[model samples]
Target: MAMFRIFLGAVFAAIAIYTIITGTSHGWNLVPVFFGDMAAMNWPGQFNFDFFTFLLLSGLWLAWRHHFTPAGLLLGIIGVFGGMLFLSAYLLVASIRAKGDIAEIMLGRARASAIGKQ
Candidate 1:
């Protein structure tokens, strides 16, 4: 759990720094560049497609984790668009809130509590 927290922190920091640097240089207009790569149908495009699928899965998991409530749906959208920016921080916080409980970390509070009762 400690290692996982550390890893999430490192991922958040690294991605934050990279985003700042890239945004400063490119002015944050990422949608076009992101899709443009896919349109070109090359290696970067292939990688982008793969990455997009992962984002979709991440979003879906987040929604499912919260049982697809309104807030869960909102989180799912944000997870897709915000990507690691949202996820790393979210996981870091969730890890802290879960207090080393892997089930709680993955399942959210209510579900985790229900499982615990079982």
Candidate 2:
């Protein structure tokens, strides 16, 4: 689980970095590709790069701690799960076209609902 957390943290950090870099350079054109076209058309300015920076840093911190307080755990789970879902939905067609292992890939989703128990 720790390894999984670390891997997820790294992925999110890389993504946040990419979003910041490319968005600053190209006015967030990368967002539509990274997220979705609908999101690109209606992105919330409140949930911009700074928000992602906080999210990415929080994920990294929680992963390094090995465990979290209930709220932190919830955040970690949402970060992992939401990230996976968003990525999966966006890539489903591509994966199907490439004949990839969909089930294996989907196991990446760390359900946020599990955090409700905490």
Which candidate number would show the highest lDDT if scored against the true structure?
A: 1
lDDT of 1 by residue, 31-86 (tens): 99999999999999999999999999999989998899999999999999999989
- Candidate achieving the largest TM-score: 1
Q: After superposition, how far is residue 55 of candidate 1 from its true place, in Å?
A: 0.5
Please give each candidate's TM-score: 0.94, 0.30
Model 2 error, position 92 (Å): 21
Q: Which ten residues in a row have the lowest lDDT in candidate 1?
A: 92-101
Q: In model 2, which runs have C-alpha deviations exceeding 4 angstroms?
A: 29-118
Candidate 1 off by > 4 Å: none
> How many residue-pair clashes does candidate 2 contain?
0
